[model samples]
Target: MIPRHFKLLLLGAAICAPIFSSAQKIKAPLPNWQNLDLKADGQFGISTEKAYNELLKGKKHVPVVVAVLDAGVDIKHEDLKKIMWVNPKETAANTTDDDKNGYADDVHGWSFLGSAKGSIQYDNLELVRQIRLGQAKFADPKNIAPTDKEAYKAYQKMVAELQGKIDKAKESSNNMLNVALKFNSMVSKMGSRNPSKKQFADYSPEDPAETQLQKIALENWGTGDFNNFMEEEIYGAMKHYREQLDYHFNINFDSRDTVGDNYADVNERNYGTGDAAGPAPDHGSHVAGIIAAVRDNDLGIKGVADDVAIMSVRTVPNGDERDKDVANAIRYAAANGAKVINMSFGKGYSSNKTAVDDAVKFAMSKDVLIVHSAGNDGKDNDKEPGFPNKFYEDKSGEAAAWIEIGASGYIDDETLAAPFSNYGKNTVDVYAPGVKINSTMPGSKYKEQDGTSMSAPVVSGLAALIRSYYPKLTALQVKEILMKSAVKVDHKVTVKNGDGKRKVLFSDICQTGGIVNAYEALKLAATY
Candidate 1:
């Protein structure tokens, strides 16, 4: 069993100083992180010394591999380029499957969205579509087949969920329209169409036309750089707002029809095909930069691990991902010798969990570790279930090496867990910094995104840190070590309930109410 005080020691270096340089073998802390040490000379690179001695001074563990199964990585981001996993046998753009692994030109990894038919966004409104079409299809006397009881039941649940999405989408869409219209009206009096953030910030309302337009712009997008805020800056905001509208408001549009293939069909492998460089893969690029992005290159942000290789497996879409794609991506990572898998995506439904579950089991059997996001919905999830949980087995001791991570903020507790993060009593193992996190995005740009999606990779990065240094630990052991020595938080912070109200402590939200601190984990790694 894992020790319980992992979280009690999250206050600061003072509490962690006791475990320094012990003879016991345990996880190590960041020896001297240049970023964490506020009091350092002109020198750069690692800085904290005392914490390092107690953590990673003399640790012994296995070098494990992590698999990142997300939209896809840029693979070229300066910080992420060096560590991208390379396929030794496969030739790039040669039009031949050199590795004989079914994917063509899979130099880095596989892409389930490589084809057009497989590249549809998540079915945020699938339940609504099923529900709207259900009664018509089921009640139609001339229909060729009677309604499936099980399918109907499933559809019913999804439809109820659809109602929720539709309501949310409608509300957000209306709010956006209101803001846009208000801005339009304000600008109308000023005789201007659209103004940038700079213009709005510097303008005076006394100018009649200019003033109205400025007010409109300020209200709509605020006094930020409207001309350029990076793609993710606006895109991330838009995505979240739209999801709020679709999932929480009154507008209910469905678009699950675009992706024509059934997600349960493993035989349907060759579906999506495209160059990894596309408009939709912005999320993947940013995540890649965080995991293995090249460091000390005087580039953008530094990745978590050095001496790393990233595998770009494009399995996620703009919305809910299909089970088949997720499963196939896992297999691709495992087959391509991927050491780690980072999954920064999730949804509330899975039509075919068996395939994804089996693939997770397969990866664990092969000693591969899978890290995933706990999701962005701010609801207490101990009452709900998220996809890709592998802790259970069929009366056997065999369990997949899986880690479910929640989002953490710069501040501890309440603020520690990103309000949008989904939590579980025993399912989610840990949390990491995910709120307003600064990382790489698409278009050679960097921005901040908030979600458990971002939190998962940080844990994956720490896992990679352990795996890269100590390769002997199996996937399960790594998961145990991470959780066992986690910074167990006991602070009673407020949480956002489903009704969007402040509630109680975060412990009511996740399995273990603590964040994944690499520093502390390293400390345990050194002395455990």
Candidate 2:
């Protein structure tokens, strides 16, 4: 069980490096692209300009509705204001559930974290609870012995898995410390209060000054674009280093063991209360701005969809999301008329698989499309699975609306697929621009970020584009169109391995092996 206290700390932030693709060399650029994040660039407006010039002039489809499920959105964001999804049944700012669905004045969406206030949510909250319960069940020393031997073996396996996480956390913390120390030393040697790369690089490579600086730059921070160095980037390493140290060395992370309450108790619909101000609204607001923040408004940034509306459902807090909350969020999006849903989060453990899967099934039944981020752990998803997968092992369903996307970059062929993006031909469906992605932050600010979290919203905008222009297609069909029409890359790319090394020929990581092209998807949809 992921404890409540830990959950409060968990919700947050991916890195992308270049990888090899089957396409041996970059001869031609992928053409007819559409959908640049509004928060990213005024250039993204060029993509929208193309959409209008080529596709939108003659189109008459209704505006699309996309739901962003993450931290709460800054409802006051200028770009996000007009398009906010209002519950028609209830009056805004009034203390009545005019819709009478138990939730009061849920004009935009409901916040689940406030109700489960103290409890922390982890990926396998339920699974952890089960393991704990089994341990408590038999006080007898004889009970400790495996009855069928198989029983003892199962327990052993579970224990080993939990122990693996403990090991990894420790390892990660150590690595961060090593990296952080290197950076600290680099700063000390330069003696420059704030050493930008240029000042540091004024020395020659053969010179001890340059050699040491280059090695330090590569080892500590990953890149050396001095001009583009984010405030978050320079300090993020220090932050990561400290946070990991606490996670591993500290005895208490209260969020670690919270899998209590009958998660399966579906009859109890009053799962959470009405505190919409989630612990962190950063990721959620960033996602929300991507899909439907009004474009060409000269505000912080433009969103992908023009006439679309946004449904903000604050479910994720600082850590892993509760199964009950996730499931309910899905149903809420579907019931509230959201045509598309974007989920930019995932965890390895899902204690209440039954509830989680049920929510997915319900979404599919309602024909609502879901876009998910392939986790940022950088391991091949095929070898390391993340929870809330799009397809069941059986592969029985012909049409699955859920999509798992990896990160891409606006850089050249060399930096195409980010080294950190999770890939698996069977698991990751596609890729999108995630490296140095610019989007809306809380407090109505515009900022740059990196992660599959950014990637999911880029595609969500495209999904909204397709659905907006072609409403006739069902959610399942739209998902298929997006995948099937994706521009596949034949380049043999380079990707980072589970160990911090690089590996080649990782093109097969994603089924599509291509960055999404909205223009192509829309063109394909027209035919369908």
Candidate 3:
């Protein structure tokens, strides 16, 4: 699954362009809105500031370790460096496995997608791979056995969906490239790379062909500022579509060769290198910052909790994360004393869900909380399954420690729910502020992102807060406290349903019927 943050940004670029003068600086909508109290500011925030001020004031807290399972975390981030979970038993820069945990020099954490050569950046979806592998079985239904009837049916559905995606990708790629070429040709005629709409329009047209091209460019690129839109937006979209058509949908490309792991084996662990920070670190860095960016640094925004040790477990890549890596990541988090695990990546298919489920159970047994994103597909999660979910296809319960989260927004109006967030009355547990969330990025920088990926870590940070202060509470108890203490909304809200808006009760989107409140949860934890 692609990181939800980038998807939101790209989606925004397609619809709107920022119109502002260089002289007039636009003030950012408060960077710490997610930490504000709803009653005080009329925003759908988690009241993190209130929690620290009232409940956690002068209280002693234990240091809780939180594991971030995503692409990769920048361990050396300025605000995050000091809070990284260091392996006390393992020696850094040593060739030997000092701790004897079947990993070498894993000082910060481990990477299941890394090897001596490099990290994997692209892979075909499991559904695409399955279709390629079972082409014979799908080609003729009569060849399938009675017991294999159900599997054959599943293959048919997967093939249909894959074909649709491929067709859509090809069409979009062709359309974007054509428009970009026309736009670039106009820019060349104007003799400037960053051409204003007025400049292009005011210029004399050479022929009927030039007039037609300029008309199309003006309609798509807008009649205002055109800074970075051509390169970052148009070119970016083209690159994504090209990659989708070439790599993600290509059955011939095997991404597993980079990791040197057997694709068929799920039990194999301890096969990857110790490069916790994989090829891409932006996604995981943002996630880590949301969970535990240092407070009082006066440089960037403070995290939900001040006292926490972040454990980095790199597993996710540019494409769908493999099941074997996910299972091992969970086991590593549980075994290494990580009390809370934040899993912000998800896909539509699962190859070996049982292995992942068993690992989830193992983490639950160790009393580790798992906070997962409900996904960014803007659909009901109760109907559609996302991998690493709370339950398998059979509906057997996985873990009590698990918390499924949908994305919320700072605005408290009809658009409270994030337009792209996936929600479900039965599947999702609670909602949290996720839109325009400012957090850490790579190179010790900060950026605002939007996604349930951001929302999941907000809850993970709250889980770490509870576990830190209320050390006696089990993972399940912490989950119950968080859900029971959420701030319930009383009115219905309008959410994006495909291209149109639909009015839905806030309670109908999630089981909690409320936005998570860190202050309320901590207050409830004090009673127990």
Candidate 4:
């Protein structure tokens, strides 16, 4: 589970009333449009196919390892199994630390959210954790020490924000329940669980109550099969809101005991199990697929890089990821020979940012490139930077091998930038095809997701592609080539600015002011 705002953006649809049915027929874009070129296919994409055909044709490339640091990954998925990184020293399920790297049976990768018993599926948000700790430390706000004044002030603000979130979650959950009940009643009256749009429109009520339900359905849903709208969307939103109250915003909720690690020890790295594919592998699997899912398999969608191995490093949970786990995951990946790392998860706060920064420096020292999502808050990253970013907490220096990616759509007009994608002229490095990106899911399934989560992997895949063909180029050089070789978009594009949309030149919002192009980057890589 990402932040609520990020999850909503990844869903690619609003969960509020007057919800539009995904079942509504609409003309779909060309299959694998993210790899198609704008000039050749009339779709705004990264031109991956063109790169493979023209630039990388018949090229003997080394296998580049891309570490996917997210919730988890489906290592057994048809499209991903063949390309998963296997630990050469550690054997699978033998309960032995063959590699002697403090991890046992890490055949694929490691799961920082797991333990010898099981894995954590959900956890409290960072805000909740902060409040929980603050309330204990500063029980008497009036007797705060002079040095604790600022900490107490921030705690008070967090308390207020947590209250607001609780209220909103309760209201949304109630609304969903009411809407679900009404839809169920309407279905009961119709004597059909799966009624067509015409059937719903032609419904005749036998009583005033039923008539009122019919009117509400028509007003909220408009048209389409009510079952899918109610079951998938409504119930899903209801569950999300319920989780927000039960886990995310709940100060008493603590799942750290399951992991059996010292909660206060930010430097502890010898904990967790080797189950990289935890209880929830959907998000990570999709991200891995976007990066490298066996391109020539012809089973699912083709990934951006053909000769790459995906290393699963499970760090994120259903709620906000802890900075300690993120730090450990980065170190683990960098030490395990990952040339590129994709971090598709982020939060607004970090409890131990220094640990993460140190880990980032370690990765940098190892010449590994990290690609991170710019976030889905639609806010300027310059104003509200995401956690575990390139900037070190102490501001000594920034990571040279970092790429911040924003989401873009498959369009060349004003809608090119994804409305939910976060951007900044000095923060976001480039944009990538993210809207309606189809990728591999858990259980050998596939899904089309939207968000900067999807976009970051696009850039990561490109980085892996460059690293595969030109292993001599440094991570910083690859980052520069990717940014400088982006396809410049001079026209203005519509973007979300608070509650309203605004049109701005693409160059004004991001450093490159353009979307990433694989063809151009590969061409530049050859020159390097």
Candidate 5:
């Protein structure tokens, strides 16, 4: 079981850190990192290209369905449209559940964030919601029963910590927005849409404010080019702040109403609409592309797997995904013949962990492998409970089909571990290339996104490849083989430690102590 102090450590680290590695610097926007050979590039990449060229040169494998439970995928994405999974039994726009599986018109996959009316865009974090619901009863410890006393204490602690985080997020958002506004005004007045530092270096501003703004821009933006500094750094920071204020820290918002389901009842089914791609499709689309963007299409980037069908399970929202939605998404994927499920979203708190556990069990029963991101808290997950984990909070074994993944960088340097990746020798199974990962975005766009969110799908894509080629391997077997076949590295590494950096053995972070390798995994699969 995770110690009580471990949970507190998670809260502290999560509050201090950004959701993804802010230290992630934009390199050449390319897709080679995810498939780079370790020996050639001095990277911890999965050797996806090598696997395709050598191990899987003449292999003809069956198509495998991979469920992506994320903020919602753009099923109509140019590179993803043809490779997306379509329910053969369900008819589109027919006003009937033709599949007879409690879902109607689930052509690509089901959307659990919506109802007949519309879809949700925002929601309260589970910690905030829990505090609000139990605040009155736990106001005074004197009235609480003995059995409920521990829970009451936990509620109080969580309330205090989460509230602090919300306050900090609000302050950060205000500061970033203010800076962004100032920069925007300065840029507009400068007359050049894409002005460079060299252009500003020669100018002398009459206004004091203009002088100050110019100085600020030169100091920060001069080091990097103007376009990159604005679009990659400042704009990215603004988006992060906006998401924090409008979604993660919003307490009064309730998206469940849009879903029109009793969130308390995990048994509730078929309460969502047909729009699998919710209001946001960027995150999920990016994830989908990492797993199975159309290969050899001369498109933006080729995915790791060639003949894989991406099942778009839209369960995640702008904020934390509810346990009910997650449970339903897993079961839906399992029932619909998905060999693997990639969950790129996770929360620190779970209101109904048992519900998710039961669903995981159901998925495992149907031989569905689950791949999850270890989170970006920069804390040890063996001690902290990242919800939807391989084991329950009580330390009881839950699912053998699950693979907990941590993010790694392409280069083999001191900053090998992605600055934001959560790791644990016992909890995380393997590491994957995540930093500055270029993949498909919504509206036929392509962008570089960094996070464990990207790493999980890299493994998911590999898992699909293995399962497709070796159809006889069970979910548990695949999980084990992936772990055992990982390219182990025996060296000390530097990882994030809240405010400071810490050096630790690579083995201390993840069980494999190395990076996931598609070539190695395929070779092992052949043996199986």
Candidate 6:
């Protein structure tokens, strides 16, 4: 699946490296800024502290289950172990289906990306998969049948887009190589020594290009060793681009056999393993911590919701997620007792939209609230629709219990909207604090990350908070209260639009024209 945060990291290293070279150093935002209020703490947080102090001081609450449908989670994490969902009927690590629910020993949740043998970490993008499946039938225009005209046209478009991506990857790879070479040459000319910032500033360059390169090295690399920077950051990015060409965009690359399921079947539910913590649980673990890490444990950062259970449904891999796995994951969560599902992963294309739509409908029928990240492409989602959206493909209706979120920074001026967040006035419901958010990571550690991936969990945690306190309200009612009680931004904010930045009113980009405020939402929930 496409983790929005990871995609932004690749973009920064690949496409925006040049701009970053000339950029000034930015001060890191204060930790736990996402819970602080703007008026009370001078940060554009969700006012969670205010809600806890003034609204929910002595309130009794039930535990709400929030299903994280993404790249798996570390279920045994120190900060997350006690808050994880446990199957009451099934036992952990047993080879039998104790609960009689078709899955064997699904203690926490299920992993649709794994099998009895191992798990699938990397796979081709959905676009590449489409091209690979259709090449034999639509490779040549002369062999196209009249019934396949539209399909053939779409196939051609996929080819063109794939080629464009390949070309860009190659170009970025070449740029990074050139930069590495320049750094090496500068080092050689300076008697083969990794210089400090003062040394770099004092050294004279023979040419203007070398001078520019030296300035970039000083500003971006700081006093770090040039060799390590080249190996870890520069060459590492080059290797990533190479992988994109060889694996992500490669039509011949397929990893579905690892899952050992019938690839053509859209409704196969008996496959996959019971291990929710797959090979990589970094992204999912961070997301879970943001939602339901134990509060006041004095061990790690507190979560948005105090009383909640995190259910891990691993459907995402290193690449784009399949529609079948996503649909099954949603069904699994809904069939169980997950009142809210947080989807922090998305892609641009959906080969099987009907399956996902039906699963979403199933979740809705079960009174489950689904929250999705808008995306990190910095484009208007209304123009370029993202998958797992609220709209159904059959032109029937939209989901009433869905909340699409965009990322907002801690500042309220030109930097209010996160530069990488995708926005749409009719698509994105609200914004949340996502910039420099510190949370639990794998290996009992913690780190800061930024994206709409981070933003969705903020809203999800808020939703769980509301559901825990107001158990009588339906999922649709919670969605309404969150949207209606959001903190509206009347001033203009600067947002990224493709290659440039533009100033627009917050209302012009999101449906609520504001950020999600927990205090206001809980206050509004009390009335309901």
Off by over 4 Å in 1: 1-66, 116-154, 184-224, 229-264, 267-274, 391-400, 500-506
Better of 3 and 4 by lDDT: 4
Per-residue CA lDDT of model 3 for 238-315, tens digit only, reads 787777778788777777888888867888887887787888788999999999999988777789888899889988
Could you give the C-alpha RMSD of every candidate to the true structure, in order shown?
10.4, 6.6, 4.9, 3.6, 5.4, 3.0
Q: For every model shown, what is its TM-score relative to the native structure?
A: 0.76, 0.77, 0.88, 0.92, 0.88, 0.91
Task: Please give the RMSD of candidate 5 to the true structure.
Answer: 5.4
Report the C-alpha lDDT of model 4 over 102-152, residue by residue, as the tens digit.
Answer: 899999999999798799999988989989999899998778999999999
lDDT of 6: 0.87
Give the number of the best model, judged by TM-score. Answer: 4
List, residue by residue over 1-528, the lDDT tens digit for candidate 6: 444335324533533354433444555566688998899888889999899999998899999999999888998888999999999999888789999988998999999998976998888888898888889787688978899999998888999999998998788777877877876787787775666567667779886667667665554452257765565566767777777888888888888899999978998998898888899898899999999888888988889999998999998887899999999999999999999999998988888999999999999999999999998888899899988899999999999999999999998787789888899999999999888788888788887778898999999999999999999999999999999999999999888777788999999999999999999999999998
lDDT of each: 0.59, 0.64, 0.83, 0.86, 0.80, 0.87
Worst 10 residues of 2 by lDDT: 8-17
* Two-way TM-score contest, 1 vs 3, winner: 3
Model 1, 209-296: lDDT tens digits are 3343343334435224554421222233345556545443223544434445554466576555434544466677767766656656
| Model 4, residue pairs in steric clash | 1-318
User: 1 or 5, which is superior by lDDT?
Assistant: 5
Model 6: residues with Cα > 4 Å off, grouped in runs: 1-21, 24-27, 180-236
- Single out the weakest 10-residue window by summed lDDT for candidate 3: 17-26
The CA-based lDDT of model 4 is what?
A: 0.86
Candidate 5 positional error at 372, Å: 0.4
